[model samples]
Target: MNRSNASRGGVAVLVLAGGEGRRLGGGKPLRRVGKRTLLDHAIERGQQWSDTVAVAAKSADQVGNCDLPVLIDQPGIGGPLAGLASARLLDCPLVLTIPCDMPFLPDDLMARLTAVLGNEGASLASSGGRIHPVCGLWRRESLMQLPAYFATGRRSIMGFAEVIGYATVGWDDHWFVNVNTPIDLAQAERRID
Candidate 1:
């Protein structure tokens, strides 16, 4: 589906591409796995689950060729929370956050998370007993609490989730492998091949 058809279900997909990619020598979103950039792969997956897909990057230049709406993270606050905070600008009631570097993110991620979201306001993805805090679905109301959280100088996505209370949807560990370094990009290339 195209961007015009997205967010029809009251959910918006936010792709977080603001990381410095220090381990991968920077510009991780531009790194290619075959003919496509990691950001391209992420946008593709995001479009599959939501009609209103957007990118949360430090700047529009960081998103490369993807033409989705860009949400610039608030300066001075780092990590996924910044991206989550940027999402508050969206009109949707629910927001799904996905990291750009995870090329193999699950197709059913939104379905599983939304199914269990219930009345608690949020749901996060978990694999092999490890929670992927960035891969979460949050209520817009819950996100309003973030600015205060950032004010306290804390930026833990998991900590924010714990305070809001969230459900966990377990997935296969292999699916969430992220491309944080050159080696990971190479490995992702192999998987794509």
Candidate 2:
């Protein structure tokens, strides 16, 4: 089936690339892993499940040039929460958020989350005793609570996810050791090959 048809049931992928990446130098998305940039790899992973893919960025320059639409972070909010809020307005019924740097996320990740999503606020991926809210499949409408969530002086992905109610499916921690520093990037390079 064409990639478009795979997600015609109303699912879209939103690659969250808005972080400043101060720890790994700037331009985290542009960081190279193997023969591809982290953004490119994340986009490819999105394409594996949906044709409708977008990048949620802090600014246009953050993502540079890309064919997909770039949803800038909401006016007064930042971080992954802002990315989710920007995507909340999407026409699709569901949106899967994936960090640009988790290159080893399981191929069945969305499927796993969707299977347990039910009527909850969102379904997230967990590993090593912690939930990775950035790697979640959210009901688009559930994100409408963003404004309310932000009012409490909170701006964390996990905090908002809990406020809205969420379920998690655990995975091996190895698949989620995200790149955050020069040393981590070097380790990712070795793993990629």
Steric clash pairs (candidate 1): 6-51, 6-52, 7-51, 7-52
Task: Report the lDDT of model 2 for residue 125.
Answer: 97
Model 2 residue 96 lDDT? 93
Q: Tell me the deviation in Å of residue 177 in model 2.
A: 1.9
Q: Number of backbone collisions per candidate, in order?
A: 4, 0
What is residue 111's positional error in candidate 1, in angstroms? Answer: 0.7
Candidate 2 — what's its lDDT?
0.90
Estimate the TM-score of every prediction.
Answer: 0.94, 0.95
Model 2 misplaced regions, further than 4 Å: 1-8
lDDT of each: 0.89, 0.90
Once all C-alphas are superposed, what RMSD does model 2 give against the true structure? Answer: 1.6
Which numbered prediction scores highest in TM-score against the true structure? Answer: 2
Could you give candidate 1's per-residue lDDT for residues 1-193 as a string of tens digits? Answer: 6655643568999999999899999998888998899999888998888778999999888877668899998988788888998999998999999999999998889989999999976999999999998999999999999877777778888888987899999999999998999999999999999
lDDT of 1 at 33: 91
